[model samples]
Target: MTETARDRLIVGLDLPTIADAEKIVSTLGNDVSFYKIGYQLVFAGGLEFARDLAKSGKNVFLDMKLLDIDNTVAKGVENIAKMGMSMLTLHAYPKAMKAAVEAAKGSDLCLLGVTVLTSMDEQDVIDAGYEYDPHTLVLRRAEQARAAGMGGIVCSAEESAAVRKIIGPDMALVTPGIRPAGADKGDQKRVMTPSEALKAGSSHLVVARPIVAAAEPLAAARAILAEMNGALAR
Candidate 1:
């Protein structure tokens, strides 16, 4: 089967309003197949925007990173599955993760465990009272999700190589904290370029500012796609 572009990258809609998000969608169109709806835009446009995007043929990755009681999160997952979202993120709690996977069972939707926040560093985890190293934390979370029968995980591109090694070839690794070579890292600590991420076994790379904040958004998207294409060619 021909691979879909949506499998390659998930673009974060880091813009302020629905108008800005729609503008980016109009610019890239089918060049990008997956769009991430996180706290900001979901708060701005509500679930209707996500449903509209899915209706218009864009895969939605709902990045809520929900961490809550099993029943509440399971209901949320059920609602998202009914809405036809292809991917949803949940924090790595064994019961919650399993609940989410069970909620999505037999549906096309995928439940992804969030390993670690891209904005966090070693000190951040320590400050939060987690004694393990960030890498160890990510892997442990990934293993938890795997045992829960979830589809995959959300981790930084820096940890993609190690996560891939631990999870093996079949389990997907959707990595964020991806910056193109020479782009500003901004608040993110661990990051990788598109080519580097693909080479490191990331099933999909999530990029935000480098493309959205670019002076020319479409050009930026094309450039990242080119980088991904180059890596595939190699």
Candidate 2:
């Protein structure tokens, strides 16, 4: 099936308050259909907000990045599954990933295992006591996630091609750290343009500041979507 621009874009709602989120949604209007509600909004009573989005017929990517004991993560996945979210993210710990897979077995939710934060570099991985490079670690985690029956993986675009090679075409590769041309990288250590990410085999691109923080958010979103569509055309 041919991919639509909307299918390839997942905008992050990293705003602080529900009101701010509502404003962004209102501003972007129909230009955006999928949103990533991460830790900040989730902690600030965003599950109810998520329900609101679902009720309004918009897709939500709940980016809680849950990390806990097997049973705890399973319970969390169970609850998120019931919310009708399009996708949910969790740390790629073996036990947690397996438990989440089991919990989401009969649900429509797609569970994604987060490999590494785009903000972390090789030195940061080394500082964290890992002897391997970031790509090696990401590939290892991607394998583990696939083995555990995760629907996909959250990785930087720089590593998506290697991950696609390892996991094959069916596994969803959702790449974050997407920056448009001339945009700030923020704290993200690994980043790519929208076209670069798509060419690297990203099934979906998660973008935040490049769109949300722009002077004209809708225009910014359209620009990124155009780049994404151009890549798809190629």
lDDT (CA) per prediction: 0.87, 0.92
Candidate 1 runs further than 4 Å off: 1-6
* Per-residue lDDT of model 2, residues 1-234, tens digit only: 128888779999998999988988999899889999998998888999999999899999999899999999999899999998999999999999999999999988989999988999999999999888999999999999989999999999999999999878888899999999899999998999999999888999999988888899999999999988898998
Report how far off residue 36 is in candidate 2 (Å): 0.2
> 169 in model 1: Cα distance from truth in Å?
1.3
Winning candidate number (TM-score): 2
Clash pairs, candidate 2, are: none
* True lDDT of residue 57, candidate 2: 91
TM-scores, each model vs. reference = 0.96, 0.97
Please give the RMSD to the true structure for each candidate, in Å: 1.4, 1.1
Segments in model 2 whose C-alpha atoms lie over 4 Å from true places? none
Estimate, for each residue in 1-234, the C-alpha lDDT of model 1 and write its tens digit. Answer: 114434687899987799999999998887899889999988998478899999888889988999899999989998999998988999988999988988898798988999999999999999999989899999999889888998888999888888888877887789899998888999999999898988888888898888888999889988898888888778
